[model samples]
Target chain A: MSAFKEFSKGIYAENPVFKQALGLCPTLAVSNSVENGLGMGLAATFVLVCSNVIISLIRKSVPPKIRIPIYIVVIATFVTMIDLSMAGFFPALHKSLGIFVPLIVVNCIILGRAEAYAGKNNAGLSFLDGLGMGIGFTLALMLLGVIRELLGNGSLFGLPMLGAHFEPVLIMILPPGAFLTIGFVLGFFNWLENRRQNN
Target chain B: MKDILKLSSILMLITTIAATALAAVYSVTKPRIELKKQEALNAAKSVALPGADLNAIYDVKGNDKVLYYSGYMDTTKSNLVGYAFLTSGRGYSSDIESIVGVDSTGNIIGIQVLSQTETPGLGTRIEEIRYGESLTWVQKQFIGKSAKNLAVDKDGGEIQSITGATISSRAVTNSIVAGYEDLLKQLKETN
Candidate 1:
């Protein structure tokens, strides 16, 4: 695949959240607000890109039998780094993101990318793949956040958008709301892909 | 046997590197993280006891794992203004931790949720700040209520539960009541 194709595929064609359905846990958990979505997205992206590059660099030396543990250690290091730095620098964001930050260590996208693409690809290509995938994940979370925050809170990014008269759906920001939103979004994307294929 | 040693060696090397990197990162961030936590506690203290002397606040460790802070009006520490303490209760998902301040009379001065992992949008609304308000609506509701009588309206108390978050609301209220009683008992024993 071309370099651009590798970088761009994660945004739409092979989105980690909407398209491929990887890392749905964090996506659904933090998509309650745009700020959270954005924070989580960027945090995950950093871990993904860094881990990808390092994993690709070490892939040749890694014994296949031990690669999974190596990958986990690498991923976990990045997660803890981000977690501590966030706690130090962005205390409010850290408090809000809470357990989800550490949970990113288990997020399938980072490991999946490291194992599948980065393991086989060059470091440079792996970096692009990680960036693309990270951006795709970020965008997907933001879309969910926008929808949920707007309908659920009658606000966008905590700013009142729908005014006082607008009663929020209430369910849109809850767990059920997350499932409902993701289902519709997944359906919509699938519909779009099907239409494109038909045409 | 040779391949096993090689694989084990590689795995060990990777983990050692990972551990070193994490240690470095932790060392760099530890002080800053502590500073942030201290700052948050300080902020919560001031908010919980509006106008209480930040410097004069001191902690009294009770026998039963209860620690409460006494806040005074000045550094001279002559005039006691209020008491602040950390309290927590089981919420829908996680423990709802809060710092509550009460005057010498046991009426709540103010409260600040130190941390909570409750359900977002519904239960987490406990931290939501309405327009043009500094204190969250939930925090404001606790002001001036007698800690002895603290309970959600669901349980026939005066405090109103956050809409759709009765559990979280009840958690905060019950925790405050329990903590306050503990504080009074501790204070009596110490005096």
Candidate 2:
């Protein structure tokens, strides 16, 4: 596949959350609200983009024996930058994101892109791949957030669309709800892809 | 020999860089974090006491420390109203932070939860309209009553616990009770 095709495919055709099932920690954790999911998704994107560029630049020097460690350090450093910016500028968002921000260093999407694409591709290609992948991840998270907030909260972003007495589904906002919703969404996407192939 | 030296030097450089970066980030963000926390405390206090003028506020112990915001009535001028205290306890899932208002008479006027991460639709009822906003059912149990009554009604106290959220109800009550007992004793000596 062309570099652009590989990158854009992640957007929805092979979304990390709904399709490939990658980078799930923040996907499930911060997705309680669109605001939180979007925040975390962007942070992950920045780290993914920076890590991809640096990894591609230094791919030759990364001894195969220590390549994993090198990629980790690059990703970790960028994650720290996002963490610091959030803490300094958006304290509330920082508090909500909390430990998940630091945990981005190990997100498979970042490491997977670095090791697979960045290791083999030119700097330009790796950057595009990362950007595309990040956008895909972010869009998935926003979708999850919208559905969860609307169902559980009886509103969107704390705004009530339903009447005051509209009792929200208590189960929709709980931990089990996250697992169930994501599972059903994944299955539906797979069914759609399968039907298209059969045709 | 040269290879070993190069590897060691690179590793050392990475460690130093990482430590310096983390330290710098902490230094810049620490103040903003603290200020945001203080602003939250002020907001909580204003909600607890609608008309009183706040004097000062600060934290004690740890992240779990009790936050105290003292204020004086505009009319009495010198009379000290009870201190609005932030307290918490280890609930079944997450720690609960609540602000309990105490009048000078050692009576609890009201209480409100600042923030929490408990089970949504379940323990989150602490912030629900009936329990948090209307506060008539839950918050009323604390009003006019002293710390002595801070227990589940099943435990032979006046507090009416939520049907399904008993643990969370008990968690807030116990924290308020313990905090009041300790603060009341300290206030006795000062008076």
Candidate 3:
């Protein structure tokens, strides 16, 4: 594949969240507000790109049977760095994100990409792949966050856009709200794909 | 045998690198993290007891998990505004922890849910207040109410429970009341 294609594929054609449906736990848990969505997305993105490059650079030396453990160790280090740094620099956001930060180690997106793409590709190509996948994941979370925040809290990015009279749909910000929003958004994407194929 | 040895060595090398990197990052960020934690406690103190001297806050050494901090007017510590303490108890999904501010008259000045693992929507509404927009937080129900009156309306008290989060609401009210009682006992002992 061309260099640009490698970077762009994860954005839409092979998007991790909407298209592939990978890493939904963190996506749904943190997408209730724009701030949380962006925080998680960027954090995951950092982990993804760094792990991809490191795994790719060392893939040749790593034996096939033990690759998974090596990949995990690398991904976990980056996740810890993000977790500790966020607590120090962005304490409030770090507190809100809570367990999800450490949980990033288990997020399938990071491990899956390291196994499938970075394990075989060159270091540069793998880095691009990671960037594409990370941005794609961030954008998807932001979209879900916008919808839920506006409906659930009558606000966008913590700003109360709706007047005082506006009563929010409480369910939209709850756990059930996470499932409902993702389901509808996924359905919309599927419908769009179907329409394009018909033409 | 040769392949096994190579595999083990490579894995060991990777693990070593990962550990070193983590240690480096942790050392750099440890002081900052501690500072942030102290700042959070300080910020919560200010919010719960506005205008109280940050320097005059002192730990009263509770017997249990409850944390009590006495805020004084000056260095002499003769005048006391009230007490701010942290209370944690079982809620619907997880432990509900709150920092409550009680005035000298035993009225709740303010209550801030410090940390909670309650369900995201219903039970988690305890910490859902807007700062300047409108104070609709579920915890605000306790503000200005006397410690004696800190029960859900269903129990014939002044506090209004969240519609679907009666358990979570009661958890908070009961904890605050417990903290208030403890505060009174400690204050009496000290004075």
Candidate 4:
């Protein structure tokens, strides 16, 4: 596969949230606002790319029996680093994200990428893969965020867009809204994929 | 047996490296993080007791822990404005923590939710500021409310609970009330 193919696949065909269904916890929890969704996406992407590169570099030396533990340690170190830096630098975003920042350590997307792609591919390819996946994840969250924030709050990125007359759909920003939005988006994507395959 | 030792040793080495890296990051970020936390607390205090001198505020310790803060109108520390305290209560999901300021008469002056892990949309609306408003609706409701009238409307009190978030609203109200009562008892004992 070309370098571009390796990177582009994660954005559409194998999106972590929509297609693979990985890391939905943060996706659902923080996708209510564009700012939060973007922050979470970038934070997770940083961890994912960093961990993927390190994991790829160390893959040759890692014994299969102990690779999982090693991968977790690497992934955890990056997660904690991001968590602390975010708390120190962006306290407001840190407060908004709350526990989800630390919970990124448990996000299966990073681990899955480490185990499946990084462990097999070279560091260069792994970097591209991680970047693609992170962007894909970030985009998915932002899409959901845009939908939720617009409908639920009648605003986009904290700015009022729909005006006073638009009665905000109360459920769109709630927990059920996360599920409903993701369900429809997932269905739409699946339909798109089926059409592409049929053609 | 040899393979087990090798695997364990490798895992141990990886963890050690990870720990060391984390320690370095923690040290670098610790001061800034502490500063940010202090800054947040100071900001919340100012909001809770508007015009209270941040520098002049002093902690009232009980059981070797800070129970509340006594804010003064100025750095002279002569004129007492009110008391600001941190309190938390179990909400629908996580603890809803807030800083509440009450005047000398024990009527709340202002309040700010310091931290909460409530549901994102419904429960989290406790911090929501409606269009064109500065203070959140929940914070605005608490101003001038005394401990006696702190209960949410659902509980037959003056405070109106956020729609679809009665549990979280009640949690903040109840916790503030409890903390306020505790502060009064402590102040009386000290006097």
Q: Pick the candidate with the highest DockQ.
A: 1
In terms of TM-score, the best-performing candidate is: 1
Best-to-worst order by DockQ is 1, 4, 3, 2
Q: Candidates 3 and 4: which is better by DockQ?
A: 4
The whole-model lDDT of each prediction reads: 0.90, 0.76, 0.86, 0.90
Superposed model 2: Cα runs more than 4 Å off: A1-7, B1-4, B56-69, B74-77, B128-148, B151-164
lDDT accuracy of residue A152 in candidate 2: 82
lDDT of 2 by residue, B1-191 (tens): 98767766766676577778777877887888778777877887866654566543323333565435566675455755557776788776778888887887777876778766665445766666641255644466676777655688877776778666688878888988887777766556545
> Which of candidates 2 and 4 is the stronger one according to lDDT?
4
Per-candidate TM-score, chain A:
0.97, 0.95, 0.98, 0.97
Clashing residue pairs, candidate 3?
Answer: none
- TM per model? 0.94, 0.84, 0.91, 0.92
The residue ranges of model 4 lying beyond 4 angstroms of the native Cα positions read: none
Error of 1 at A48 (Å): 0.9
lDDT of 4 by residue, A112-154 (tens): 9999999999999999999999999999999999999999988
- The CA lDDT at B136 in model 2 is 40
Question: How is the predicted docking of candidate 2 categorized under the CAPRI scheme?
Answer: acceptable
- Poorest 10 consecutive residues by lDDT, candidate 2 chain B: B54-63
Cα displacement (Å) at residue A37, model 3: 1.5
